[model samples]
Target: MSVGLVIRLIVLALLVAFLVSPQTFVFVFRPLVRAGQPVIYNQGSLIDLTLNHLAIVGTAMVLATALAVGLAILVTRPFGAEFLALSRSLANIGQTFPPVAVLALAVPVLGFGTAPTLVALFLYGLLPIFENTLTGLTNLPPTVTEAARGMGMTGRQRLMRVELPLALPVILAGIRLSTVIALATATIGSTVAARTLGEVIIAGLLSRNTAFVAQGGIIVGILAVLIYDGLSAIERMLMRRTGQAGRQA
Candidate 1:
């Protein structure tokens, strides 16, 4: 494993320990709490809150990836090429609206809790993934694709075995970007009764507790950094494999 990965794991372990026994952080948080307030955030278990936050983000990302990648693939095909403009416009529409606005509009229709958050994040994440997938698919080398066809590879075979493999690194780059953005943005879900680390930050803000804000911010920041680094490593590995395949061929 990479040094960064190891370090991230260590940080994650420490974060978990802190969350499990937040009182262990008394020395740090005690000073930040108001004169009469307790050192720990007792509203909910941090572990539970973090898990719920990840669930919301993960669900949104999965939905976004499926829609974005599927649409990109469709638009890249000869039969679907005419839809390119429409696809781009649709993805742009998702991004053009702010997440908060999306949430506000969705809440009345979807009701409170995770639904609105999921909708907001799904829309927020679509543009990057779609754009990157489009770039990856459209930018493949013509010679390589022609060779696949010359070798009697069917279109589906060429797409699955040749094009997508080469384009994976680029696609993964989009996923990494989308995931990071969703991680930060998911915190906003707390406003609509979603259980998230954002609840801690919001509570802190409401009660004037700097400790709560710091703890929430630190956990979210750590999660984003770790996930980003992990995806980058995966992308690099994919790129290296593609390079090796090209050399051997």
Candidate 2:
């Protein structure tokens, strides 16, 4: 009945379909291909590819979040305010360059594997997080900061006990956006010899097998949706807790 319940159900369904009965996808994808063509992507296990894809996205997000949030915190401080413009420009550069181009340039040095894909995803996932974190930190109500100061809170104490808790929801929203972007973008990594669902899509493209492409695209789509929903549920929970705390205080 509730939105949270609906999201949990959707996430459960997706996980069951992908993990418990992957063969179910064969029937779904079969209609997209000719009768004689194989309906499943047989070159690599879909589960393995999915895991690898998650690994890539997860690792990149960790790096991106750390740097983006760290930079955002710095820029919001008086001493670091001057670096704000430069940080924005740096974060923008990542989104400006296409993942393919980043791969093209990185492959020469990283040489065709998960490393370059990680680099591309890391760069591609930075801007949204940085921008959102900056907005969250900078836009806090002046009254809240004054209250914290009045309570004899130091800058670090205010940030740790007051600001960060308040900013978490907005910061998480940014992470959610960046993560969804990375899920789709990570598929491009397969072009550089990285293990991803893009391998299935690319194979299908090469062989003209629509089913393979559909299977890969559908799985990625479902994953993105499920992950987005999961993150949203967490965000809503955090917001509710934050509100409850505010009311009690």
TM-score of every prediction relative to native: 0.95, 0.92
Q: Write the per-residue lDDT of candidate 2 for residues 1-249, one digit (tens) a residue.
A: 998778768766876676556777566677888868887778978888989999999999999999999999999999999999999998987889999999999999989999999999999999999999998898787889999999999999999999999889889999999999999999999999999999999999998999888878987888898889889878878878777336434
Off by over 4 Å in 2: 1-11, 244-249
- Residue 66 Cα positional deviation in candidate 2, in Å, after optimal superposition: 0.3
lDDT of 2 at 182: 97
Q: Give candidates' CA RMSD values in order.
A: 2.3, 2.7
Candidate with top TM-score is 1
Model 1 scores a TM of 0.95
- What are the per-residue Cα lDDT tens digits for candidate 1 across 13-33? 989899889888789778788
